[model samples]
Target: MKRPVPRIDLFDVRPDDERAFVFAQDLRIIEARLFSSAEPQTSTTLRPHLSAKADVGALMEALQRDYAPRGVNLLRVAGGWMLCTAPDLAPVLNEQAPEQRKLSRAAVEVLAIIAYHQPVTRAEIEDIRGVSTSKGTLDVLLETGWIRLRGRRRTPGRPVTYGTTPAFLVQFGLDSVQDLPGLDELKGAGLLDGRIPAGFSIPLPSDDPQLHEDEEPVEPEPLDFTLSPLPTADEDEN
Candidate 1:
């Protein structure tokens, strides 16, 4: 029997609707990985970025409204809004996101200190960590969405202060630091050990006299962001 004539595969560069749709999904996931690798943007960073961009805009808007009452914030980034935690809780979110990325323990600690102690200088984070932070560590965190430069402190040498972004909150899935797990859970720091250190004096929201305890504090309720209505695909900027 003669073999069937070989046919060349068609070279159709134009994507069909289904191919385009699946391709779009693949792109989104790739973008997520890229963004995640960039820096510590947020703890619960993945879903929020996905929802707020491109196709799912409308769904995101609805989610914000649903999650807002629980103290979630659907923040509009300079480019567009993404779900973020309340400003005050930046430090806690960073702390909770340890090991989620390639960050070193020292780097995560520094990021937390900056988020909580914003407008603070490198000297300050070192004081808290009881170790000097490498510039690359801060650079990594900055590249990620977790922290940013606030401004120079009004002091001699005018050291730069760092702060957390709305993106940071989103990545960490926190509404506010007040919602951070109680002292019991933090001390149970499986990866890192001990309390905020003996001499560190960052202001805390706890009423308990002993803010730092032997055991880790109980973990707070995970952030519950209420989604909000956003533009439809027709109105999407992308």
Candidate 2:
């Protein structure tokens, strides 16, 4: 004899019609988890409490709405969500503790070069700067979480190319690399001389985060090679 088929009620309502109540309870659970944790939580980390059909995006939206006017606001940071102080409160908070540890001139220059001419190799940076760049300068930018190794050039020796990170866009208040100051803006800001050669221009920067036609995918930096000094301008000439 054939076994009877089990019936599954996809829309079955629970007692007291408590589905909405259950969602609200789940929202509270998520809120408590976020509040108690010191670090930002990703959806994957918070999914255990939610049913398979639960909409994590909707829950996050609701939480964001609820916290919009509060002292703490939900913010997307470094590709994850975190609760952060309101922008209006920043000035008051900053007054209590001033910023220290400014970037050195070399570090600043290196950062600027990487931001503007990204996916650039060390040799390209040196060529633009008219001086040799120190590995320490690159290290400082890396430590700041502003720039990252993108890939290696397809040319000889496959030197690693560098590019600005998403953190760089967040820190600089830029929506995209294309929003970087152009020649006209630079001239207006007095960063560049008003009098310049005809057809002088800044190349439009790309933030595509993909290896270009001339680039090979990045390989892991060798453990022993990372500490070694990068080639200087003189070394490049030789």
Candidate 3:
């Protein structure tokens, strides 16, 4: 008879060092899942595949550390984590994507006001901008899916309030509306005048999806807008 083959139970005879190796293997699996996913993965969605003792936070931290210096980085977006190219690579990647149309100056101003002071009404936006807002301006923003009607204010006339959408956050690369640059940051970027106004401050923006106590749900309304004819060459000349 052949010499009895030495029987070794890998699981039963595993060394203490193997525990760390197994933990690392688990991290690799998590990393692969996140890397391969098209959308961000939440901890709850990723936990089932992990052992009971596996710490999701620690695994995510490890993956973040590993990719920190790489072109791709793990980012938290909309309450979940996803892999994204580093900010430094934006210019290069932007060239690969289609040319994005820029918002008009008026639209930009209206959007900024709405973002910073949301649950704001058309009248409020006009007041802040010191001019009357054309219905077409709001229509353009609504069509773009950036701003949305929040609810009607509980005051007189009960005008519809507007707020920024998640699409706005994503378009601006913001994780939340709270991440908007503060007044000081705006001044540093030369976006705000450095005038010395005592107690001047920026309002904190909230992304709360629910209607506030002062707001009422919007009621379905028939569209009342009509398009005007484009200006002809003769009209343009005049």
**Please, what is the TM-score per model?**
0.42, 0.63, 0.75
User: What lDDT tens digits, residue by residue, belong to model 3 across residues 138-225?
Assistant: 9999999899999999999999999998778766667789999999899999998868479888999997999999999999886899
Q: For each candidate, how many residue pairs have backbone atoms clashing (under 3 Å)? A: 43, 0, 0
Residue 8's lDDT within candidate 2 is 22
**Tens digits of lDDT, candidate 2, 1-238:** 6332222232453556566555666677777888887556678888897766666777777778778999998776544566778888987788787676899988898888888888899999999889999998899889998899899999999999999987786675455688789888898899998678788767888867878999989876677645768999999999
Greater-lDDT candidate between 1 and 3 = 3
The parts of candidate 3 lying over 4 Å away from their true place are 1-33, 36-39, 48-50, 196-198, 222-238
Q: After superposition, how far is residue 75 of candidate 3 from its true place, in Å?
A: 1.6
Report the C-alpha lDDT of model 1 over 1-238, residue by residue, as the tens digit: 7333222122332455544444355334533453345332232544544534333333334344544765545653423344456667777687676564677878878876765555457888888778888889989998996776655555576566666775665566555544445445555766446545676444552212221222222234566896788889988956
lDDT of 3: 0.83
Clashing pairs in 2: none
Tell me which residue pairs clash in candidate 3: none
**Candidate 1 or 2, higher lDDT?**
2
What's the true lDDT of residue 13 in model 3? Answer: 47
Q: How accurate is candidate 1 locally (lDDT)?
A: 0.55
